[model samples]
Target: MTKQTEELKQQPGLILQPGPSGWWDSERVSSPCVLRCADGKWRMWYYGGDPHFDREINLPTGRCGLAISDDGVHWERVKGPLTMGAVFEPHSDPNRFDAAHVGVSDVTYNNGLYWLWYFGGDSSFTQVGNMRAKGLRMQPGCAVSADGWHWLRLEGPYRGALLPVGESGEFDELFCGFPKVVRDRDGSWKLYYHTLHPEKGFLVGLAVSEDGLHWEKAGQVLGPGSAERFDERGVGTRHVLPIGNQYVMFYEGVNNSGYHCIGIATSTDGEQWEKQDGDATGGSVFAHASSGSGRWDARAVGTPCVVPQSDGSWYMYYIGANEGGSDELTSQHQIGLAVSKGTDYGQWKRWGE
Candidate 1:
């Protein structure tokens, strides 16, 4: 049975936290890209940062680290050979697309090889009203790995990126970030990425690839929810899983009040998506812990990484923020887990619950 805490609900699936060595992930660890193989060993590739790391971007991102787990609950960090124990970092050249910072969004093992799809930004700074933000021109990039540690960059047209931002007067002209890829049944590929519109908030765009290197833009597919809905604000990092004959997308949505939660959407062709009505928290199948619960995820939860189990259950590894963190950007982000009740995708319980 799950243990209850006073009147506040607990986030029992809260397993991995930030590293304590004050190295790379001492301040915040987020964006979990977990892969569970046939041998039952779990490998999670996540991005994190320390306090003194990039003070200009406002988002907690710099380098990515790796963690290993036996049961997918308890995790042990691997001492990587990169800087500050990071498995991957930004490019060395200032003219590169990922020269500033990088974050892994998808890690797929196909035909005895691992394909890592990530998003990165340059050091160019842009002044938005009163604040100065760096690395706003984010773009998608790709890399391949044999041992999951050493990687070789598959350079794209836009300075090591698979796709570039949209042209003038386009929806994604602002930036293209957080790329997630899914292989279709016909051996073709679909790359899903997002961009922030000044008026429409955040919208998800698609691009199809034949060889997973060259891509063609497919326009926007998913956007913000209805008025006063959980995703009324916008959509963020998401994962698309092909289960059975249909495709399911677990995405992050931001409300009007800047609170983030995880929402569900279904599609038959993987291009046209329909948002399913969520639980009590508007359109979110999984919501953040109550604000007064004093939990690690009291403030917000987003960036879902869902994995299916053999017994029909599902595991969703996500990033959460506490009340102490300010507006999504300056928050102290951490990683946690949530489990669905049996095969009930709409109903979920934090791990241990």
Candidate 2:
């Protein structure tokens, strides 16, 4: 093996799994929004479900919870006030956009408060092919917390959504979900979200806000990769980090076989992007373990959240799945970690390695 490959170690296993027995996330858990605060305490906000959760919805998102860690490795769950110990949940108002289910996407600490950007779907259902999907019309929402437990939502237009679905024939005509926000140096804000199109597959789009509340759609920024590439199916949930003079995006790529992996792309202006080649084939910076390897993340890996460490390394917390099920979306998912080899962002090793 090359020196670069030898420096990396394979991921051992999942760092966090489903909640304890009878908790809200006892069934499955995914989509982590983690942060290391000024006090050096690590907090993670993620969404998941229980046995009684509504099965009509396709995704695992139902309620949200919080986990704390001091070393960013071992984690302890914090019991919340909501039903079955959830920090935040879907809106109770049926007229609101997120009345059905919600998932935490990004959380930022600013001015002594926690700002949460999340996506949720209403009770309404839509007919896709032969299946009638409930809570499929997703949209983005905002909420603020004083102690990161009790939250108060900031209502928005279009039934409490910060931005509504695109008009007919638009790139985001389906829905705008997974809101990842980046505050620019000039005081403006940029929100990144993704939507899936029947023909276009998955595409990432942008919206800008002057004050972090009101927003305007800025159109598509990134889309599917070239044919037969690691991300040929499309780019999904991602994290954007401003590194020195350039903006780096750690994004999830879906292949034709429905396998998921992590990829890297760089942008000078944070609007347009160019994919960078990685150690893996098809330009993926990191990929799933070999098929039938009996690894937790062998089937797919996605919804990446990258954090810079104090020692000049990087930590990536992502969701991993196995091939126990027929389709990837229906497979059981758990959260795992990977670290970059030193400060080389393009090279990574699993947590234990």
Candidate 3:
């Protein structure tokens, strides 16, 4: 996959879409995070659900909104979201663990405040194995926010699951969700998430934190591949970039026909990794978009968020899906973008496709 990752295929385009009637993403919008604020303005935190679970639309377990953009491709939806309305609701003190539902998988602003990482589901995955035949569990949480729109759960409201869940048959026990963090230079903190590998599917794991509120695992750095390749069957929603000293993971792979693409791995100390090969299925640098077949996100793409553009160039907010016949998968998914400049900024190209 050279010619610069095949000129970076599929070329993502739709910037952010999903919402039009009564708001709260009317029907979709999945994991996205973009921040570039020091007053320069440009903030975004995403997640919009009700993908037809339709419990009236305002409370069905998927919230995490807040948008604003001076040019991150036109956005503006600051009408309130930080989960003040409850969707998954519960937590009425039923002995906590996110009470019953909560899914907000990435948001970080370290040291000064604002840090949220989530995935808590006590049941209700609709259909599709009901979280593994009703024994139900999907935990991996943490919360805190001083100004990023009000949030608090460092240990209280539903007691955010810090990082610990694998026991019975372990590999992250039963489930874990998307979380990709980085902070090293001695300050200590480097997480990367995605678990549920009782058989080598959905892999990516590694944990360690110093003050971001306790965490320590440090087990699997990345996994799932070679069952045919292209991410063999599952790899995990991730996003990490720290170019200079190494460490650049922008994941979400999944192939074996379950679709999903976008890959790249490299680590110097973030705990050993290397995936960057070529063609036929040699460590995809990016996938999905067999020419965007019928639009609205050709068919599958990962949840990767990369932002850094005060002029230095690089913006890659991702989450795209279309194959809605099965009622769409991955939390309804939608939101896209891609760009790069000086030095190729990691050679992406789906913003004008």
Q: Is candidate 1 or candidate 2 better by lDDT?
A: 2
Candidate 3 regions exceeding 4 Å error are: 1-20, 32-46, 49-103, 107-115, 118-179, 182-188, 191-208, 214-261, 266-268, 271-273, 278-286, 304-318, 321-353
For residues 222-332, write the lDDT of model 3, one tens digit per residue.
Answer: 787776677888677888888877888878787766777777888888788987654423357656667437665566777888877766788888887775544343434
Candidate 3 or 1, higher TM-score: 1
Which run of 10 residues does model 1 get worst, by summed lDDT?
1-10
Q: Per-residue lDDT for 269-293 in model 2, tens only?
A: 9999998888885789989888898
Query: Runs in model 2 with CA error above 4 Å?
Result: 1-13, 327-329
Model 1 scores a TM of 0.95
Question: Which residue pairs in candidate 1 collide?
Answer: 13-351
lDDT per residue as tens, model 1, 202-233: 99999998889899999999999999898998
TM-score of each: 0.95, 0.95, 0.31
Lowest summed lDDT across 10 adjacent residues in model 3 is found at 126-135
Residue 64's lDDT within candidate 2 is: 94
* 267: Cα error in model 3, Å: 4.4
How much lDDT does candidate 1 score? 0.86
Q: What is the lDDT of residue 77 in candidate 2?
A: 89
